[model samples]
Target: MDIPRSFRKTLLAHLPYAVNEDFTAADDLAALGLNSMGLVQLLTDLEETFGLELPDELITEETFATAGSLWATVSELVPAGQFSDA
Candidate 1:
């Protein structure tokens, strides 16, 4: 599966009203209504799904600002093509 797409799917699953909406890399999660609890859930899901641990320092407002930014952080820790199907 595509990492970002899977990420988006997981995010939408956690959100109450995001089922029909289209999400993009540039979309701001905060503006999309992701609160503290949602963020915590997202982090937990991301870690579990990707099998990677995020550093404390990387869990900043800016890091979760947008899908692209979050993907950048994930990519840094996960390495390229790790989640891409062969």
Candidate 2:
């Protein structure tokens, strides 16, 4: 699935160092400066923005490893018919 624009905006906001880079879905977020604290904040932001609670099982390092992985997780949780480019 494609990453939602809102999701990208939220992800970019947490990645301070990556703002100027041409980051892609496969880019390593950690290398882009997404530390532990940033990850937590990102999680909270994503949850609140998407209006969905991430299940414990879904909270894994792999899930947040890259933008694509994170988007995959969010796409799975977003309510059907509610997803939009915005």
Candidate 3:
């Protein structure tokens, strides 16, 4: 589960309960041992890392089921028009 350093660090820091290998988009995020409190922190860290204000529409269970999926969604939501700002 070697991924971008930033993603890996962010995942480890935020989703402390989740492991790096849970890269699929169907893995239970909660099964990884996350609680509702941790999920909020993870979202905040992800938003800060990617520089995108993610709407709940993209934060659904289907979209954030795993580490890889979370990284993909963040990469996709990142402001393509301005990387510097991000």
Candidate 4:
């Protein structure tokens, strides 16, 4: 599976805001209404879904400021070619 696409879908499913396909990678999640609790939930879901144990340092506002930024972090944690198309 495409990690970024999956992550984006998961995030949108949990978000209280109405994010559409028009949403870009540079869109600020906080500004888009993703509060702390939502962020925590997103993190938890991501960890469970991806079977990842994210380090504390990786959980930062800067790292999750945008979809692309968060995807970058995931890309770093999950090695390339590890994610499957299924």
Task: Candidate 2: give the clashing pairs.
Answer: none
- Model 4 Cα displacement at 41 (Å)? 0.4
Each prediction's whole-model lDDT (CA): 0.76, 0.84, 0.65, 0.74
Report the lDDT of model 2 for residue 85: 73
Q: Worst lDDT window (10 residues) for model 2?
A: 16-25
**What 10-residue stretch in candidate 4 is worst by lDDT?**
1-10
For 1-85, candidate 2 gives per-residue lDDT tens digits of: 3666677788888888886435788988898889999999999998898899999999999999998898888888989865677
Better of 2 and 3 by TM-score: 2
- TM-scores of the models, in the order given: 0.80, 0.88, 0.67, 0.80
- Model 3 Cα shift for residue 72 (angstroms): 1.6
Strongest candidate by lDDT: 2
Q: Which scores higher on lDDT, 1 or 2?
A: 2
lDDT of 3: 0.65
Lowest-sum lDDT 10-residue window in model 1: 1-10
Question: Which of candidates 2 and 4 is the stronger one according to lDDT?
Answer: 2
Estimate, for each residue in 1-86, the C-alpha lDDT of model 4 and write its tens digit: 23355666777866566456445778778877788888889899888887787899889989889877887787677756655542
Where does candidate 3 clash, by residue pair?
none
Winner on lDDT between 2 and 3 is 2
